[model samples]
Target: MIASSARLARAAGGSRNWLLGVLRGSSYGTASEASFQVESYKLHKLEQGPSTSVTLSRDDGLKMYRQMQTVRRMETMAGNLYKSKIIRGFCHLYSGQEAVCVGMENAMTPDDSVITAYRAHGWTFMRGVSVQGVLSELTGRVSGCAKGKGGSMHMYGHNFYGGNGIVGAQVPLGAGIAFASKYRGEEAICVTLYGDGAANQGQLYETFNMAKLWNLPCIFVCENNGYGMGTSVDRASASTAYYTRGDYVPGLWIDGMDVLAMREGTRFAKDYALKNGPILIEAVTYRYSGHSMSDPGTSYRPRSEIQEVREKRDPITNFRERLLSSGLATEEELKKIDTEVRKEVETAAEKAKTDQELPLEELYNNIYVDPPQGMKIRGCDPTIMASTR
Candidate 1:
């Protein structure tokens, strides 16, 4: 009956009714307006913070929910393929941190830039790469965004730098990108994300200094996901209050698990960074999977703790409940979206699994954007000189 209603709605004209008239299944449509009480941003060295309350329209709610759900499902599929050994080498799943990327991306414009660490599947998708693109990249297929070469931690999108493999490498690179934007006098800002593990890197502090010195428009985000490579944040850093770690730069501590909170905080930070200089944001999130595909993620932390977070603070589930309670959506509507997401992800997974990888002759093809004419690059062995495609 629900499927029939969906088909009927689609057949009618694929309007808003396609989402509402059928999925709503009610005389009165879902609430047109809703206000949610998101967690307040904890400020440091700043006079004001983002509002504790945020207004949500059905459109925004549905989009945010769907994006987060797609990321979660896609990451799950990546994990499954990795376990089966199809996706080899350096597979990092961003399962429990969906809200961070989804919320941040929704607040960003295409003109804005983003760069982040290796756990970048979610960010890659948020930046416009499809699930198929990300999965195929992981599987080293010809159809990947990087054309099967970059692999898991090197995927790129427009205005998105990379899935940088080095622990603290992307931070300074992001600063440079912001500097370039300022140099060109473009009204753009760059959001550079790193994990709690990278918090202690000296290069980050050096980049922070340079960013502030030049007044570059950069938002440095630390996704403090409690544990870093099996070690707790407490063990990783002497001072875990990452927001305050940037002594001169202003900071905001945010509830990373809450999508609304993340959105508001990022929106606020983006504006502040453009007007003033760089700002620091510590998004306190959690990760359900191991640091990489190789670790089981159980020896260091208790399974019960993971269960607790899933039960009490799972981002997707919490957002779904909020949508229902606030009348932004109905259970049936959300369920329909979930069903569609699963099917989309499953279809993408199948293609990624079966897609063809780049052939051998194409090697060293993208060595340089504009290589000199007749440039023959060295191949695997010095004896083998390869011509540029």
Candidate 2:
């Protein structure tokens, strides 16, 4: 009977350990910094480009992994919320394109400016906005970064210009920000991003010409995600080589699926732009979800193609494997990080869902940085005026 009791006790102990493993995740050991070679970059109008070698410390690797995971999870949650009708209006999901923002932000400083098109949620988060802030903005909650006014497309952070809703409109504005940095005698550079869809805009060419003429320290990025909305890039663009489209401006075609590559290429681009003038970078990424919530994303492209890219070229998964293979992180450690990120996103999402909307009186409050006492702003009806006091 004593032996039977001993066996039962051991079994119970084993079960408890298993449960603990499930919750806390096991750690193998502390990972150290290491250098690994990344893919070579495709250059445009340049003699050379960024080095392929990249150094990865444990801290940076873990941070990048956690960030990419957080964005992915947050986007997934946003999609769910949108589907449930909790988030109204246009909602763009940045699932497969996590590496672009994460990688570029890692290479940039807080003083550097960024502006992008309507697909700005991930960029907003990378620019230092919290998950709750992004979700709340999507939910139109009072606690959002924009006081729930900007919604999905117009969220902003410090030195990080808000996403512009108009296609290709932000490029010229980004140049202006770069011009401001130069004017102020600051070392800051502006990173302006737009999608492949906006590549054909005439305003872009005009902006490019002016930026080159002024030698503006701006990095114009084209996030070529294969398709422009439901239409394939090939069908829409006369020249699919977006990086080389900027004839006078130097460009780099980066593997947007590789975060490390993105970082290195961006680092090079920033330095080159600071020294020379405006440059272009085509981040050849893929979007897993539809253009907005409205697009199925698979109608034009085959579902098999999307699945293939997810399985083969997914940025998060590829980076995870790179970390493990480089001995930068163990599976257990990554799992633990994943658990934390998932919980953080889930918690933020819950708060976003429950947060209150701004009071109607605040509609015209922020129209001006400083409004005169008893300032009145026109409402939807020209005859109606709203008090800004």
In TM-score terms, which candidate is top?
A: 1
Record all residue pairs in model 2 with backbone atoms less than 3 Å apart, i.e. clashing: none
lDDT of 2 by residue, 1-389 (tens): 11100010112112211100011112323445556556668899999999886777778989999999999999999999999999999899999999999999999999999999999999999999999999999999987889889999999999889888999999999999999998998888999999999999998999999999999999999999998889999899889999999999998998888898899999999999999999999999999999999998878999998987887778898778667655567889999999999999999999999989987767765566545656666432222334333
Off by over 4 Å in 1: 1-29, 372-374, 379-389
Per-residue alpha-carbon lDDT of model 1 for 212-293, expressed as tens digits? Answer: 9999999999999998899999888889999998888899998888898899898999999889999999998899999998
Local lDDT at 195 for model 2: 95
TM-scores vs. true structure, each candidate: 0.90, 0.89
Model 1: weakest 10-residue lDDT segment is 8-17
Against the hidden true structure, what lDDT does model 2 obtain? 0.85
